[model samples]
Target: MKAAVIGLGVEGKKALNSLLKYGWEVYATDLNVNINLDNLPISLSSVDISPQNDKISFVKDNLSIDLGFNNQEKIDSCDAVVLSPSIWGSKIAEHYKNSGKLLCDVKTKHRDIFTIGVTGTNGKTTTVSMIKEILENAGKNVLVGGNAGGGFEGYYDLILEADKQDYDFLLVEVCDMTVGFCNHCFDFDLIALTNMGNDHMDVHGSMEGYKNSLKEFFADKIIFINNNQEYKEEFRELSRLAIEYSKTDYDLDLFGKFNKLNAGLSEAITNFISENTFEIDEKIIKNTLKNFKPVEGRLEVLKLNDCEIYIGKSDNSDAIKAILEEVDFAAVFIGTPRHNENHRLDILNEVVNANPEAIILFPGLEDTLDQAKFRLHALDYQGRIEIANNLDEIIGFVAEFSHNPSILIGGNGQENIIKIQDRLKEICDSFNHKENRLLFED
Candidate 1:
């Protein structure tokens, strides 16, 4: 069989590797010029469906890269095209579809793989990680990933590694941005929409676009939804098997009611998994999750002497809102403004509304002074808010302000989060409190 793997992002690369192992003649294409093809025949352009040698290879030909969509003629000639979820559901994709030829998805297909997709405005990564730990404790082969940044390919990488042995179940944390890119997925065996909130409406355009995306996922697969009146339509659609994810809850290793909702969904889905040949151990799930260590950099708690630190997902509006709304934090650290207007506007609004005694740290990207000023002006904060983006300068600021401050390290969209994580941890360590509590939905 010949495979035409589209896009070289994490998912596409995994799908391509899978195909290669299956002994299929694979022709990989990508718009990104930075794809490392050290051991693979990844060509630069989406020239055609046929596999070419070094002559057409971007690395060999040394052609100037063009970061654009794939070429159509090649798309038409493919035996089977493996699509990344990033492909937008527009007429372009519609035209690319050939019913007779296979249109497969790297992250989707084979619901038998068994998945628990955690969805919502926030708390997706943390809850998903809890489920993953619970499963790992239960000795189930599970991989988790989706919209919370690194969760993008993180679990898929885990899955590939587990492939050397044999893995059974997969847990995925999905975001509207990634999930919204594709209207439907054939891979989800079960789903958990944590709780809906205001986010990404700029791209989704309106409430309708956002709601419809959920509609499509439930329409395509067996789903479990948050017990809120807001998604009455979604509930109506899945009335056949609707289960309330968040209602009366217990104290959880995770943060708030939002996290409880995320965990509840995972519980229901795991129960479903139990119904099969394997009987899932409830005790294991509860125990594993009791001390479930959250991922680094997400709502990570950094302790700087006599205080528990609260770092955040840098950009996840829901996670930020949750901590702000629920936790009685000592203080909150807010990141500075960015080029992305929507992010700068929305995040600042969320931060200011949280109104925690706030100290702002700036990443200081080029060309955002005016936008930053405009955003700061728009939000009226009830808490102390200051701006300092310089690394060394912020280090000094943290030293003085580190006492009992709930450090909220927001994930990057405005600034590179990986870099932010490093800096925040370094400062936390300096205070001799290396306790970082990460909160996310993977």
Candidate 2:
């Protein structure tokens, strides 16, 4: 009956509340020593406000939010430990397991609802969002979550909210790391693989390891996979019913061949779900595809007078290649961090091959710009390459000098990319109103 929630980040907070609702004695810990409660999400604020609330009193009285420095004692005393997916495979988790304690991850339980899990190196968020949209358009009560921003932040929150609501389908974005930790714990009716490519090598340690992690997720489930993926055959063998999807050539609102693949995967999953459950009209699928907007930070476009800006969160080489193949950019502002050394080389090579007019590297990357610069030089790259100290410099350069029809701003981290998107939107708004014509002209 007693549970200890580790890592009081977004997922941890949701786990704490869910455990409380399930009538478990919940204790919580956060490794962030400086988390401000006032800045916490409204979800947490709603739960913390009631002093007369039994859950609030139980947590406050028994748990200490002490940066997880003294959490081992609390964890040892608990019957079960619920871990945030971020802490999966960590030393702390291994130590707890060695001590003979029951450990569960965020993906545990929620078997009552019909779940559709989408996993791959790319297109997970978009594909899952599309499935949610298509199902909802068909009048199915659906809750979409896992890895997308705004409202549906994490799977833990989604599962908790779905439990209270009347949702016929729960669309989840399942990451490889999550699958690696708790593959056996997931009870999904169906699953989808967007596409697999070289990504997250730092975590998985090798290409083989990353692929194996994904393979573990599809076992015994009816899986929908992209037919064009290199590892499709491998994935097909593992699933109970493996459905392969190819590019549909639909004039989708989203750009890129990969996105087309995403749409194809989405449609396949929707059709499978609909055929088994209810009749989803073909018009609903077509309309949803035609009108579905691109996921934020994934090839989102903004057009100016002489140039267009494409912002996305593509951190890996394959994702970057997909974007480059779709749009010819005069310049590229890359914010992806250098995690996997081999993948970094591949990304640099792709950037060189694309041969943009300029390449502006931003902060938030693990590898230094100097190193990337050296690699570019080695590749005989002729384009302009500079490392901006901040996002402002990159924006200023693009606003002033970029004359090509399109420019790209994205990679790896969402933090910097989101900031660029907001700032660019503000600037674009001013230009649209003719209030900042002088800025662009200069």
Candidate 3:
């Protein structure tokens, strides 16, 4: 058997190793002209695929390498082509599919473990976490991962982890980037969609394109859709049994109405598993929903002095609006660390329209301050706007600038929001309430 692995990113490398493990002759290629393959352990004789030994060694001895370009001859000679998620829907991917080659996103390959894929523009991470906890509490062996990237292992990591251990189920947090083009290929027994928001337009190009991908993903599957979602009717036409996740007012430790919906989806899916596959105690599902805490950076609350600092994930304008609506904050701290947001200006506009008493623009890898200033000025916003020189400046301003009890912080990306959380924690630890008191305070 022969296989050609395309792209040498995290997922691509994992695919290469896994193929070689199954004794397939491998041909590796990357479009990156200067890709570093020194760490991509070619000699897997001593490779350790454990949780701790994530960074394996690499070389070019065992497989044929065609870096800087995708060699057609090499691809034609292979029986299968494993693609990185980043290259899904590309010309090469289309060619492989049209040619009747066994194309894979590395994630969709046949596996014995039962797979439950959870996907949505929002609340996916929280929902996946909820499902994992519910299953674990029921004493079921499960492996949870895929695109849940707040320091969580991804699908690639899960594949490596699956090689060493036996799991009854794999709870995968699917995203547009990971499974949009090749979802049908994944061997999922069930799928839970949290809700669709106006997000990922930058990647999916438009709402129609995004919805089409999702429709194809859920087609012919035993899927669960949030009842609150507008497209439930459309999905119901395609799914084998489209279960609706009802909204509940369960007394939850997590903040916001969205979380209630997330918990609802978790309950629906876990209950299904219990009824059909496993015997999960109803008490476990109830307790998990009632006590489940918010995932990090999703409506997370931090305290510094008298003010409540809320850290949230605001990847789009809808998310920004949701945060503003849920938390009655007097001031907002917004950043566009990635600047690649589909609606960067719209996100800033959303923050401005919230009419907070003040808005702070913190510097990031992108020039978020400039965009915020332009958008605010254009909107004729009269609220206080402060431009922070650095993360430390944000803390200093928050400490001494406002007497308001609530301060909301968020950004355009999760990784960026996590950074803000870390900085806030550090500053709060060393923060002196007395010396840096607000102007209105003593």
Candidate 4:
């Protein structure tokens, strides 16, 4: 038997690795008619085993990937064409499959290797990382990799590596895009939704559209969601295992009420697997929470001088809103307003309301929030509503307000976070606040 994998992105390499291990001759290709092998994720071993080298070919060169898949010659030689999720129902995908190339998807592993997908607007990566770390610490032999794209391969590799003695579990942080869901539909055994929020509308368009994308992918398995009005009303009778988690149920260590719910969902899933008696160690679960560090760019507290916080989250509006709730800031500086201006404004309004004394600063955000200050007008924001276009200016401003009880750096890119932290160290050294005060020292 032969397998053909297309689109040499993160998932492509994973599919290739799996097909090769199954002892099937595999051939792969991508839209990169011009991209070198180095640029593609495939290894030399996968290419050599390709049916293409054996006079039969696996991949067809569909010049443009976004539109129709036009190349049919490449699809004619394969016994089966493993469609990468990125390839939609374009003319090429339709034509290639019309030739009766057996159709299979990543979801085929439901038989022996049951799987779960973690999806949400934020914290999905960290939550997935925590789960993987916990599983590994318990020596459960697991694989964790997904949209964070941090080098973790897919189940195809894990299935081959199982060897009846090695790895057994898989944790994937699936993306919130249609392409992400289509791929997940065929790749895994079970699915988990970390939580849903108003995000990715630029790509998914409407809230209903994004939620439908979530529902379509995992319509068969369990979906773990929050006990919110929207989710409850929309998925009223969705058939699959519907689970809800909250602090009223568990004392999850993850920060925030939302994060506590993340813990709840993780616990629910862990408990389900535990019922099957998977031999997961209690120590592993504890270690996963205690040792796992939040990703660098996501709510990572940079400095904690005088209860002040400099935080970072991947330049998404939803993340900023989450961070605002997690900590108190006397002033808020956002590095970039990359998405959802209205959402970012909501975050600013909430932060200002939550911390009455907080001064709001939009250093590099420009006129995105021309909506102006809601509570404290710009003139009213003396040390607070300050704007600096350059890192030097922002750092100097941070030093100026180093006296404030607290300051927050919102957005993942705190271009001024590190520099300001270093400056604080100098001031602390000169003033000798070590004896009088400190960030967490008190």
Candidate 5:
């Protein structure tokens, strides 16, 4: 058997590795040919493509490797084509489909795997991570990946690696975009929805469309859903084993009522798995819940001098509202990559209504701080509004002006977030190491 793996982003690389491990002659392609393989996620780095030798080749930036086969010819010669979620609707995918080649996505290839797929607009990474942790505490050999770091780079990679390993269970973070592309391919043994909200409409087109994509993928699966989510009733007809979960009080290291609810969902899923698959001691599960730490970049708190800074990557109105509801902020610094502007404006309006001491907006690639400033002004907000030149300027301003300030840094740019996080941690560490102020003598 032969396979063609398209798009060498995280997921595509995983597919390439999986195909090779399964002993299929593989060919790969990426629009970006100049990627340094060493800099990729840890999972991709371990993929051994060396064994396939001359049978395996890559097309980079429209140029074929010296392997003596053109890109299109290699793709056409493959028995099956595996597409990453990013390239689901691309012209290349369309071409392969038209050629009558068997086209499948990362999820579909592992349809028979005993999988727990989690999907929602928010809290997906946290919830999935919790599930993985709880199951591991129960002494189950588990593989957790998809959209976040735990096992591999992407779902494709995770599934591929899981196939080779002796994992007792698989936990996957399923994105709505992935559902939109490979809904037909999903065969989850158990599924979960954290909470559905208005998000990714730019890709899904409309609110109804986004909901339907989830509805279709989750239909006929053993499902768990949030009882408090909007449109909860709509999901009732989608599955026969649909179970609804509500908020539960648990002594947890994480903050926010939403996180408490996430813990509840994780507990419920763990219980369900224990009941259906294997025996899990309730004591161990409880201990794990009590000790579970907050997922990184989701309301991560850093104390500097007299200020308390909360940094997260929350880019939607609902998530922002949840953060503002939980913390009494003196100031907020927000930066987001270009996304649905009108939706962001609505979220910003809610931020204004929260009425912090100051609002700092930073420019993303597509949207400017000036645009956000205008929106806040139009909302009749009378509080201080400032435009941040950079993440450092925002951090410096917050440290200088406000006492006990709550600095919120969020956006869609993961690279920028990592940089900001590193700088923030460095500043906090430096402050911690400084000598205490002398009360009376110097």
Candidate 6:
């Protein structure tokens, strides 16, 4: 038997292992033409297998590698083509589907362990982390990881590891990009959504398409979603088990109203899990909630001298609006990679409406500064606009010139936040630096 795996991302690597385990001659390919594995001809060993699987090695004899393009004819020759979650909606996946080839995603064999799936446009990582903390504090063994994707192992890796360990619960963070495939790949015992928003419209194609995907993915699954979610009414009729949750009064260490909603959802799930299975103390849940700090990339607060700066990932208008609701910022900086393809220019209107005193544009995937200036000009925004050379420039301006400025930094992930923090530290370390009390003291 022969099989091909397309898109050598996390899920694709998992597919390779499974196909090789089944004794199939596998042809692997990735779209990144610059993979540079000895100019494309490479062995299966070239891929990074998780240390957990170091003991279980694959037979290299049946593996053939190709990078850059997915040769339709070559893949069609295989009995099946397994796609990575990242490649789900691509032309290659569509081609395989219609080419009479058995097209599928990396599938997890049914396991008896109780599984919980967390998903939404945002708040997935925070909610997943909260759930893990609560579960662990309650003395339950848990294996947690999924589309959390911010320097965490992919869900495919976690699921495989879960099979080897005797875990009480398997927590998976499902992103919209992977939600459709997750429906077929994971047998989730329960699913929880923080909230829905206008996100990933480009990947899903349209708002209706995005909503439909969520509806279908949540159908036949026990789900907990925000009561105010747009699809709440429809989900009640579609989901096999649907429960609506609202904001809670739990004293969370995290910031923002959205975090409160996430806490509420996590609390509801933990309470239900306790009632049905292993009992968790109310005190433990409260303590866990109280001690659970905000995830690094979501509404993370920092200090530059007396100025308060808040940073988080804001890709869509809904997220930006949500942040603006909780943060009273005098200045806001926004950036996004491939801004045009990722979203429309209208998203900038939200920031304008928020009426920040000043707006700064930082370089991102493209000329976001110029693009944003054009949009702001079109919108006739009244705020002062400036271009920042880097995060260092923004930090210096806020620290030296501003009067305890409240700043909001948007449109970067956790990795970028770390880089920004490093740059801030370097600035503080310099002799020509503004002052002490730079960041992270409190």
Model 5: per-residue Cα lDDT over 84-137, one tens digit each: 777776786677656656344422436656788888888888888888888888
What is residue 8's positional error in candidate 6, in angstroms?
4.0
Better of 3 and 6 by lDDT: 3
The stretch of ten residues in a row with the least summed lDDT in candidate 2 is 50-59
For model 5, name the residue pairs that clash.
none
Measured against the true structure, the TM-scores of the candidates, in listed sequence, are 0.75, 0.81, 0.80, 0.65, 0.80, 0.79
Best by TM-score: 2
Q: Candidate 5 — which residues are off by over 4 angstroms?
A: 1-3, 7-71, 86-109, 148-152, 180-182, 339-342, 363-367, 433-442
Q: Cα RMSDs of all predictions?
A: 7.0, 6.2, 6.8, 8.0, 6.1, 7.0
Poorest stretch of ten by lDDT in candidate 1: 58-67
**Candidate 1's residue-wise lDDT over 315-375, tens digit each?**
5465566667766654555554346545534666666665656546465334354465566
Q: What would the per-residue lDDT of candidate 6 be over residues 73-92, giving only the tens digit for each residue?
A: 77778876677887666776
Q: Candidate 6 regions off by >4 Å? A: 1-4, 9-27, 31-64, 68-82, 89-110, 148-150, 339-346, 365-367, 422-442
Better of 2 and 5 by lDDT: 2
lDDT of 4 by residue, 21-102 (tens): 5666666666554333453334545433223322322332221121122245544565777655456556656765555553
Q: Write the per-residue lDDT of candidate 3 for residues 29-67, one digit (tens) a residue.
A: 776655655546544465332222222222344577665
Give residue 218's lDDT in candidate 4 (0 to 100).
Answer: 53
For each predicted model, how many residue pairs clash, with residues at least 3 apart or on different chains? Answer: 23, 1, 4, 8, 0, 0
Residue 56 of model 4, lDDT score: 24
Residue 225, model 2, lDDT: 74
Better-scoring candidate (lDDT), 1 or 5: 5
Q: How does model 3 fare in lDDT?
A: 0.73
Model 5, 441: alpha-carbon shift in Å?
Answer: 13
Q: Give the alpha carbon lDDT tens digit for every residue of 148-184 in model 2.
A: 3322456555655654566787777877667754453
